[model samples]
Target: MIETSEQGDVAVLTMSRGPVNALDLELLTAFPGALSDVAGAAAVVLTGAGRCFSAGVDLKRIVDGGPSYVAEFLPALSTAMLALFDHPRPVVAAVNGHALAGGCVLAAACDVRVMSGGTIGVTELAAGVPFPTVPMEIMRHAAGSAVDRLVLTAEKLPREEAYRIGLVDELTDDLVPAALARANALAAAPAEVYALAKQQLRAPAHERIAARRERDDPGVAELWSASATQERLRGFLSRLAAR
Candidate 1:
């Protein structure tokens, strides 16, 4: 479930999907609507329930549900990512712990990212999953050119390194408190002005990737459901099971 609370002008959205807060079909489907509901808040703080922020999508679910699941899941995932990226309000990520794959993309999509513990990374390639164009664009915008290397290598960076590479905007010992403070500060700006400025800053990314998202998303989903990708997933699952 997604939990919401108001801290002064700052609204908080907590990912409470349990344990690792895996971004499964349900969470992906509900995420955008949840954010839309809190759009009226001056600023938003997004975080997870426990130690870890999110472990990304549940590969097992895709493996079990097969092609139909991949088709629906891919679009939902893309929509949720785009929602966070395009949200008019200043959205901050209180990254309390490890945020891998889709989770990392979520943090990157936010206007500001404040991380406290664990690590953050794009592990799509490592897991033998293909990256859709939208996520690649989001990460590139967040972390700059270094993002290309990380995506290719699946290197999980510690908080210091993440901050260094611009994957996170700030790092502090207290995640929520720091993020809430940042959100409160940003909320002080005039609503329309801030929204417009934020949108302007994000336009380049949106414009550049417009055609690609329309093309890549469905294609990647089909690729994920392909026999070869399934074989790779089987190997990935086997490694997970062994662990």
Candidate 2:
């Protein structure tokens, strides 16, 4: 589900699940662990292979016996997200296509995001997939004024608008190279200082995510189990298939 390769001081983490790189339990567990194995890298560049960066969480998994998965998966997902967000080295998102909901949050958690040939937003509310605490924080931190528009409307902004709203730091024809260049620049900072600066910079969001961890995860999971959301999830899967 996750593939890692090293290029000099930068580590490239590619999300390679078929069709679109949808987040599932296995990916949730493996992504963060992969980072640990590549701890030597000064910076990490995360991207998805094939067409998309990621469509977001695997709705099939969420709707199929979703409650059980959410019970465990939500925590795991949050842990992985927070781990990437709090990683010692700079993390850059190289988004090649539509990055929605959890995928957008994953990008948001990173130090920088470069995207092209696609849209990006947090569409979880519209998709009937509930948001975990950490991902929500990522959106608020990264999107700012765009949050209300994105969450309430679930609109996937175009590349230019996405950049205008701060959804992405760079919008260019070249994704990985732009992201890697940014990562290389960011990687110049002293590792310890960079880590601490990032922790401090993200402290508010991190605290909120941690604080809401106990309270919000279950509610989100329960909503996933609800008939309405399950029906919505099914619809989402169908739409994805049709596209």
Candidate 3:
């Protein structure tokens, strides 16, 4: 589910799945550990192995597990995202292709993101699912007014649109190379100072995330477990397969 390589002080972590990289339990379980192991690297670049970056969670898992699956699934994934957000060094998403659903959330959680013009952002909220609040917090912090339109509607913002919305930090045809170069630059900075600066940078968002967790997570979790969400998911999956 992951491929790791060290380039000087930078660690490149690639999501390994053919075509569109979909997140399954295997990915959720493996990614956090892989990220933890590479914590020593001054910077980390997250990309994909094939044509696309990641398409988000596996539909098969959701179909089999039902609505409760989201409650269980999101918390675990959130733990991973939290680790990335709190990691000492910079993390960048190298968006080689489409970044949809949880994939978009993952990209947004990173310190910076670089995308090719063809990449996409799909939240799938009309399918009756929502991203973890932590990632929403990141989006709210990073994109400001852009978050209102993006998150509220759960629209799929294409690469250029995303760039205009400030969801992506940079745009390039050679995403991987550009992201790697930025990672190298970050890695070259003093580690202690970088860590402190990043911590300070994320502090406000972290605080808001914490507050949202205490105030709203149970309701959100309940929404995930609701019968309405299950019905919607079932219909959505059927439609997806049909297409």
TM-score of each: 0.96, 0.95, 0.92
| TM accuracy, model 2 | 0.95
lDDT of candidate 1 over 187-228, digit per residue (tens)? 888989999998888788888789688777777878899988
Tens digits of per-residue lDDT for model 3 on 1-243?
799998777899999965678876668778778988998887999988887788877766776776567657777777767776777888999998888777887788788889985556656676777656786786677677887787777787788888887889899988777998988877777989999998898889988887788777778777767777778888988888899
Alpha-carbon local distance difference test for all models: 0.89, 0.85, 0.79
Of the candidates numbered 1 and 2, which has the greater TM-score value?
1
* 52 Cα displacement, candidate 3 (Å): 1.7
Candidate 1 vs candidate 3: the TM-score winner is 1
Tell how far residue 177 is off in model 2, in angstroms.
1.9
Per residue, candidate 2 scores C-alpha lDDT tens digits across 39-69 of 8999999999988898888878877866687
Query: What TM-score quantifies how close candidate 3 is to the native fold?
Result: 0.92
Q: Which stretches of candidate 1 lie over 4 Å from their true place?
A: none
